[model samples]
Every structure is written in structure tokens, then in C-alpha cells.
Target: MTVSLDELMAALTRELKPEQFKDYCPNGLQVQGRAHIGRLVTGVTACQALIDAAIEQKADAILVHHGYFWRGEDAVLTGIKRRRIKTLMEHDVSLIAYHLPLDAHPELGNNVQLAKILGLNPGSALSRQNNHDMGLVAQLPAPMSGADFAALLAARLQREPLHIAGSEAPIRTVAWCTGAAQGYIEQAVAAGADAYISGEISEPTVHSAREHGIHYFAAGHHATERYGVQALGQLLAQRFDLQHQFIDIDNPV
Candidate 1:
């Protein structure tokens, strides 16, 4: 009913293979807590809200997709950052996170999970970086209008994606990258995807999609990434026979 923090960290690192990817933040065990964990909480971000929710759930370790210590972020821990880390340390809760590794995972990645939810069968990788695919191209069972595809995403993700319908043609191929990967649309276009889906969209994305005639969907970053951490937590909970809870802290962006 309990697993050591080190042991859990090792297992996660082994499964995710963080060493294989170039990530912004450190992965696997950001903060040290009690030696053993009996309750685990997983979420999209390690914000104060998630930490508070984890404490309410009496979690021993908090696992997340977005952790602290980015590449160009201010090195000093202050304000919100200071408070978040303090809360975890005060409560003796460990913080474990996986970033690029979680996104690039073949079976349990965020893109794959989103594809599964939308009933899209993956056909090929869209962007290959560091010897791993960052996004995936999926084959729809049948071609559908861009509007229809956007509606399907809204229904499945429980959030209306900002759809930029580029072409009137029915879409049979879509490429998806979760969490602020709208920049990968070029790769999707290169792959001849009828539509491209990602968490966020930029001004350039609008022009690219319109000019290239590829549908673009800007789903919420938090909403699109909610599944991967939960899936990983569920697997670990089942494997270690520990209590696992996935807490969602709503974020509009």
C-alpha cells in the first residue's frame, strides 16, 4: 500500500526516459518529502491551487506535467513560486514532474490520449525531435467538415476549441500536439494533414492555416493535457496498490 519516493521516481524515469529528450524543466522528483508514499495526486500544473488540493486529499506525493525551474525563468524563488514550494515543504509532500518526456511517450503521451478520446486512429508522427515524435498524424474513419471536427473536439474535450476553418473540404487527416504546440502546425502542414490541433494558437498560425488550407483548432492548454498525468498516476496506483487522486485546477489559458 506504500512505495518509497526514490523507488517511485526511478520507475517513472525509467518509463518516461527523460534523458532522451531536451526539456525546459527537470523531470522526476523535483522536491523531496517523506521516504514512503501511500497517497498520490496528479495534475496538469504544480500551482498553489493544485498543491492545496493535494494537501486536502492528504497526498504524500504530487505528480504533475508542469513543474518549476524553466530554462529562462527567473532563478530566484519568490512570490507565487516561493509560496508553492513552501506549502509542499511544510506539508512534507514530494513534487514529481515530467515535461517533454510525458508528451513524447508513444502509448501514454498527451497527444495519443487526446487522439483516443476523439476516436482518431494515429497514422504517423508529425514532428520528430531528439529521436521521438512530438506530435502525431491521425486518420479519421471518414472525412468530415472542419466545423464538424471542431464540434467533435468540443464535445469530447468539454471545451469549445477556437476553430479556424481554413478549407471547406471534408477533413480526413489531422495532426495533434498537446500543450502550447501550435508552432508545430508547419510540420502538420508538411505532413499533408487536413487539420491541425494543438493547445494554443498564435497570430501566425491563423495566416499559415488560412494560406495553406489546413484547419486549425486551439483547444485550451490545460484541458488538452489533463489526461496524461492522470493516466500515469492510475497506472502507478494500480501497480503499487496506493491511493491515487487526480485533481484538476481550472485554467482558462
Candidate 2:
């Protein structure tokens, strides 16, 4: 079965509800390509490597959490950006992206998927943007030391997180926001979480965590966000009977 590009876009719009949150980039169909998509590719970012791979796989459309045209970026396409867009156009592959919507989706979001991976039970939403929750507070099955929790994150994410311990006590409650959400640390502290996890850590995060007696973990931004797009891809495949693939391009940061 194949879905029209418009149909796919409408489905994504309905599922992600992109209009609810003010996003850094446009939420859906950043680039137009084939009208009927039978094969779809999803990735964390719409980088040149992922686009190349999708083209190699003969994908009809590419769906990603990160896409071009971020707000305030130079409107003119040049260098890497130009190359990426040109490649997609050459291949006749549609490009679709959902930034905040993908991150905060109730069931298929990056936060929910990461929690499922680490066995964390989600509690309440946090960090509201445009009246929509952008982050989540969660509970571990049982209390564990900050070090133990860090180890669990490393084991699951396959990357050692930078651990800044603010308390010596075991972590029972945790708060998390994926991909460069270290700014939400204050909200986590206010939520009375024992530990906080985010993709990137700013210089001020250390002081905030220590002052508030809450642990902080700098999980890799790329590492933490590799799930949502895949989940969305799988759903699309199952829904439309399209051939879907998720290609992960490595990024240390």
C-alpha cells in the first residue's frame, strides 16, 4: 500500500498535533518529493548521510525529528545545508520533520520511548510550552544510588553520561527532557526530583543541581533522541503498509 504525500502529512499532523507547541522548525513536510510514498525512512536528523542512505534504500519519503529551516537560521541555503537539500531534491524524496511535537507526543514521543527503554515509570508532565508539556517526571522501580542510575543509563544508551551528583542519597524520583533541555533543570528541582537527566548540560546546571541537592546526568543529545523517529517510522509502516527503515548516523555530541 502507498500513501499520498498529502495523506502522510495529514496523518502526521493529526498524530503529533504540531500546532500545540511553538517549535524551533516547521513540523511537517519540510520538502516535497514523490506524491505517493510506499517506502519511508526515518532518522534522528535529516543530515546528508541519512539522506544519502535513504536514497540508497529507494525511500519515497524521509521522516525525521530534526529537519532544516530552524528559526533564525540564515534563510539562504549554503554549504552543508545546500548539499543536503540538493540531494533530497535530486532523489525525489520527500522530507518530513517534527521537532517539539516528536519530543512530546503522549505515546510515541522521545521522552516516553526513553522512559520505556530505561524502565522508568512516567509520572507527570513538566516544562510546558504553549500550554503543552515538553518534559516529564518519572519514578524508578525502586530507589538506587545516583551512580547506579548513571550506569543504567550508560548500559541502555551505550554512552557514559556525565554524572554530576548533587546528593549522596539514592535516586527515587527523576525528571528528564531529551535533546538539549538542560535548561529545564530548575523545573526538575522544583518538582522535587532526586535526579535530573537531559541531553546537554550547561555550565549553570552543575550549580543548580548541587544547590538543589539533585543529581544531574548529561546524556548525549544524539543518544537520547534516537528513539522517537524510529517509533514513528514503525507506526507509519504498520499503518500504511509502507517499507520503513531507520538509519542512525553517529554523532559524538
Candidate 3:
């Protein structure tokens, strides 16, 4: 079975509701390719490596969370960008991206998926963007010490989070936003989260966690963001009965 590129795009835009959030990049099909898609591949980003892999896999479309033309990036197709776009065009493989929408989707979002993996029960939105929150606040099943919680993250994500412990107390309430959301620590603090987990951390995050008496964990951005696109791919494949594969091109940051 196959789905028209238009049909797939419409389904995605409806499911993720990209129009609701103001994002750094466009949230749907970024490149035109074949009109109908039978084989779909999903990945974290639209880098040259992922495109090459898609070409090798004979994919009709490559769906991803990160695509080209981010705000403030030079509009010209040059160097790596040019090579990537050219490769996709040569293969006639469509490139679809969902930035904030993929992050915030209620059932198949990055933060929600991460919460499920870490056994955190989601409670409320972490912060509002365009009147909808892009992250999640959660209640832990039981209190776990800060170090224990950090260890749990490392075990699950397979990457050691840089732990900035706020207090010796155990973590009961937590908030998390995936992929470079360290700036939302203030919101986590205000929510009374005992700990805040995000993809990347800045220098200022250290003082904020300590002064605010909340734990902060800098899990790898790539690691935290890997789930949503895969989940979306699975759903699309199941819905349309198209062949789907999630290719992981690992990144440390």
C-alpha cells in the first residue's frame, strides 16, 4: 500500500497541528519529491548522512523532526545544505519536518514519549507557546534521590546526564522539555518541580538550579529527541500500511 505525498502531509499536519505553535523552522513538507510514497524513513534530522541512508533504503519520503531553512540561517543553498538538498532531489525523496509540533503532540510528542520511557506521570504543561505548552510537568511514582534519578536517566537514555544537584532531598515532582530547552528551568522552578530535565544546559542553569533548590540534568539533546519522529513514523506506517524504518544517526549534542 502507498499514500500520496499530499495525503501523508495532510494527515501529519492534522495529527500534529503545526499551525498552533510558532516554530524556529517550518513544520511540514520542506522538499517536494515523488507524489506517492510507499516506503517511509524517519530520523532525527535531515543531514546528508540521513539522506544518503534514505537513498540507499529506496525510501519514497524521509520524515524528520529537524529539517532545513531554520530561521536566521542563510537562505542560499550552499555547501552542506546544497549537497543535502541536491541528494534528496536526485533521489526524488520527499523531506517532511515537524519541529515544535512533533515536540508537543499529546500522544506522540518527544517530551511525552520521554516521560513514558522514564516512568514519569505527566501532570501539566511546562510552558505555554502560542497558548499551548510545548513541554510537560510530571509527578514521579515515588521519591528518588537526586543521584538516583540522574542514574535512572543515564541508564534509560544511555548517556550520562550532567547533574547539577540543587538539594540533597529526593525528587518527587519534575518537569522536562526535550532538545535544548534549558531556558525553561525558571518555569520548572515556578511549577515547584523538584527537578528539571532538558537536553542541553547553559552556564546560568547551574546557579538557577542551586538557588531555586531544584535538580537540573543535561541529557544529550539528540538522545532526548529521538523518540517522537520514530513514534510518528510507526503511526504513519500502521495507518497507511506503508513500509517504514527509523534510521538513527547518532549525535552526542
Best by TM-score: 1
TM-score of each: 0.98, 0.97, 0.98
Can you write out model 3's per-residue Cα lDDT over 75-162, one digit (the tens) per residue? 9988999999999998899999999898888899999999988988899999988776678998888899999998999999999999
Tens-place lDDT per residue, model 1, 1-253, is 9999879888997899999888888988898999999999999999999999999989999999999998999989899999999999999999999999889888888988888888888988998888998899988888899888888989999999999988888998899999899999889999989999999988999999999998999998998999898889999999999999999888887
Checking candidate 1 for backbone clashes, the offending pairs are: none
Off by over 4 Å in 1: none
Candidate 1 C-alpha error for residue 166, in Å: 1.2
Give the winner by lDDT: 2 or 3. Answer: 3
Instruction: Indicate the TM-score of model 3.
Output: 0.98
- Count of steric clashes across candidates, in order: 0, 0, 0
lDDT of candidate 3 at residue 169, scale 0 to 100: 86
Where does model 2 exceed 4 Å of error? none
Q: What is the lDDT of residue 48 in candidate 1?
A: 93
List lDDT for all candidates, in order.
0.91, 0.91, 0.92
